[model samples]
Target: MSAALDQPAAVRLSLADALRSARETRALLVGPGVLGETGRLFREQFPGRRAVVVADPETRTVAADAVAAALAAAGIGTEPMYLFPGAGLYAEFGYVTRLEASLCRHDAIPVAVGSGTINDLAKLAAHRTGREGYLCVATAASMDGYTAFGASITHEGAKQTFNCPAPRAVVADLDVIRRAPDWLTAAGYADLSAKLTAGADWILADALGAEPIEPRAWAIVQGGLRAALADPAGARAGRIEAIGPLVEGLMLGGFAMQWTKSSRPASGAEHQFSHLWDMEHHVHGGEAPSHGFKVGVATLAVTRFYEAVLACDFERLDVAAAVAAWPAPETEEAAVRRMFAGTDFIATAVTETRAKHPAPAELSAQLERLRRDWPALRRRLQAQLLPAAEIERRLALAGAPTAPEAIGIPPARLRSAFRRAYHIRRRFTVLDLAVRTGQLERLLDAAFGAAPASTAP
Candidate 1:
């Protein structure tokens, strides 16, 4: 019965720190072979609750027996593990419904023995299906959803995030993660790298007096992002020293989302690209790309957009004419439908586009704001970007897809995705900036021209 995070020298996001700093998540136990005692850990964190283990066929092999055995050792009451059907499960509404149906009242607290998909199901089932808080035994250094409050699930042919709490506690066994797919580790590297650009978008939102970024949450995640992403090769290699921070850093991103109650701190325009792909699915040959890999390429695209923006002299731009020329709602609606054609995502696209499309009055106000604050905003945006070359170098080292082509997205689709992405969420990203200022076409040219070479490992 050891507490993994208690070891000072061996820990990155210590259990004490997780308990203290994370807004909703209670405890964290991350160490070599720590998952062997998941049952005891669960009992300590959520005593008197009937523990129900949930896993898929593959995840069960990872830790089901160990958790069941540990619960037995702890003399805690438990039900057999509820095995979900999956070769690999997609987080969609249907699957969430199935998970909800699988549970019973006897399952008071859930212990999810997997990564993104399983953890998302667990948290959603807890919130949406009337179960109390749950815990996670992470199996990979994959996406950051484990500690995040929002579940990114595909619903009605669209990728939508549902608000939920982070896992009550999280346990990551280094031994288990070292055995995970190399692509998963690489995806984690790519996902963590989105923070710099995401922060910049948040700053833009703040400037517009739209959705302002929270300073406290911003510092916690961004403060450690560089160290987290610095050793991408080591992380991909699954070295304990290198991989440990990768895990902690991803967890911190989740915590930031929880503090903000929104994924803005960790997701920006890059995530919208992933959502666009999820919306069509057929465009990617009906195979979903890893969220992290997609975002990595998208981050490179968005970083380039910021570069284009910073290079331009806003003083020369005709703000008055641009505001006058801002597309009417119906005009953009037609464009949205046209771009998202051959997919069910068209309806949602139209809805979000119209909702976020600025009216002339609002457009005029925003133009005045942008014109007045252009220089200061440009400086902040530039300060937040990592050199585009550096971003690609790190992604290449980690064996992640560096471009849309690497993830099975063609140039036409990627360009279309860029245009349609701002409509996916109302967030004011560089995409919105370009669109509002009549520079979207120029930004699109740069994104596609300097695309990162595919570097899949």
Candidate 2:
């Protein structure tokens, strides 16, 4: 993989080349007026298949009606639209089940007509009904699940990524997306910003041999990221020039995830914070916070963690002593139980922690590798990450909440999340690195001013 990375940079791919590289998605039309061409694109991608428009009450007004009319004009057969309530809609299993029931009654392909929540619900529902794929008419420059495989839905009180194919086609009309509420676009910008930390996490994992970076996947997500993120102020103000790249960046992330067959290409520890909050049902202002907002705050937190890790002198580390001090399997399990004591997700947490928990021998080997690779790894990570203050600046300029309290997470709770989030996923990230080296608590103290109560047994 490093050999591939060392090769001369490939020319940026055209949209056609990108679509071909994706595992499932076949067509993408993104422009100011592409919403009007949805029927034509759908016909080109799914000839002779009837269609059903899936949306909520608000989106029905936003684009669903126009989509239905477009299909009719194109002579495509259409089923009655399946409308979820505009309010209280979420990506949860019950909603998926309801949408599945509606989809099961028709043989038509679902044309999802909203952003993150609607797309996820329709993607999972269509997959459940044995449909080859669905069409996504994006209404906002929100999160990047549009052309990505799988759906992030809450099931059994935990946020889990259910295995499913992405939409066969996607249509993002910049005119519609630009008209979306400012915060929605801001959220999209922040979500895209998280790729910085995510990329750094991937570099760390690659160095540790936990997960090696795939060159193609890395290129797809990272190539246009900085340019896309360059004008957060313009994006927040709904400028097409800024929103265009923001949408493109978000879409490219999905394509990278498609190429990799995993979200590792686009997600890392920052995403874990969002997932942990989802499982906890954390709410602000009487509603669950938007995914991008949670992730924006988490990205800053993780960036600070990276700063601490980067400052460490790994060359002087005592690998033998660290291995000897590593927690036993049972001790780790007990700590996980303590961290999740009142939640129904304790079992899930325990299972995930145990899956990635390294034994003494394995810890020694991994630590030795880290010690050996520290210099090169540190340089790579430094190249990939932005300063925490700079990330906060971009996020604020984009109109996203810059602090945890802005999204309803108190400082103490956020501190606790630094630990709890680690146990919820088997993914190897900076959090895992900190824990293995006995630096997590110290990192937390530095990032949060003081560490919260320990969950350690």
Candidate 3:
């Protein structure tokens, strides 16, 4: 629909306009010297600013030093904040308190020096303290929250989504991203990959009036996926040239939803799956994996699961037959709870939601339409992601883990993770689709037996 910003200047204005139409124009500047370019842009965008560099200990010792040196060289006074390490951890209320205290302590204007959590926390802090700031260096290409005007933080030990202001400017340093753990990059790729499942879900939501879609925003998202998939090496390297577009695409994706004050553009079955996994991990005293990692596998599962559903000749069944085929609540409950054991809220949300809104007739109708249109949608998706096999191969090339077990999950745990995963978040995703269709159990059985093909371009 739309080409990503700076997607080869010669790639046709219609395409460029298409992409831009969907997203607010974000400033994406790339150069061999990103620090200087970014610093210059920062001054140009908002002048007369005192700077606070909110960084993780590792980044502060490494990337933040260079950022400080660059700002100082540019004659800007800078302050340093050695933030606590880890993703999601940095955005905690406690961390926010520490940062608020630090802001007052140094009278610093918040500017983050790391990516993902650091950027999110800094952005939140800036929103709270009314400061202007940007990201310096980091990995975490996984989550779409980076550029969105919202933050998912833990409140009272439960993961909650909070309204957050978008960054005044975002400065992503590719050098740091490429060198960081491969899981982070792979997670980022997985996040991008989930767009299809999300896109499909978004389409269904819009069709049923559950959500609205903007053609312009959809185009930009489509274009961004194309650019990311087209350049495999650049994605792995985290260089400015490669990462600039990725960050831009993510920003556009976030904006597509943010501008509309909705999340339909960037979430779907895969996100639900990821959220469930997140909850399960928390419940079992298990470590959390990257958002992208969970979404990646979830995306694959949803795609295959849906494809199988489409293959079923539903027209042959009468309404009574379909009704009888619906999954029982006890079965659904047990599966969901077992799948998402660690997170009570997630399991409860999913189980309760299905109980309240049983829409098998509607779900069946939509499945019919989806089956008829599956070919077109599949072509469109393939045009963007290639095949599922290629996506798996690319993930492997990046040294990113693929299956649940790859990320330190045991087989039984993963099975449970899949079953209960739908309960973690409030979103209309493929997991929801399976739940609504009364086919989740059979799908789970198949999942354990046959690894589905990739849906990536």
What's the TM-score of every candidate structure?
0.88, 0.94, 0.78
Best by lDDT: 2
Q: Report how far residue 300 has shifted in candidate 3, in Å.
A: 2.8
Better of 2 and 3 by TM-score: 2
Q: What is the Å distance of residue 166 in model 3 from its true position?
A: 1.5
Model 2 CA lDDT for position 171? 93
TM-score of 3: 0.78
lDDT of 3 by residue, 304-413 (tens): 66565444443443445555566665675666565445545744666555654445676566666554555554444334334556666766655566665666666555
lDDT of each: 0.78, 0.88, 0.58
How would you encode candidate 2's per-residue C-alpha lDDT over 174-285 as one tens digit per residue?
9899989988998899899999889888888888989888877787888778788999999988889999989988998888888888899889999999989988889899
Candidate with the greatest TM-score versus the true structure: 2
Using TM-score, rank the candidates from best to worst. 2, 1, 3
Candidate 1: pairs in clash: none
Which of 1 and 2 is ahead in TM-score?
2
What is the number of backbone collisions in each predicted candidate, taken in the order shown?
0, 0, 21
Q: Which residue window of length 10 is worst by lDDT in model 1?
A: 1-10
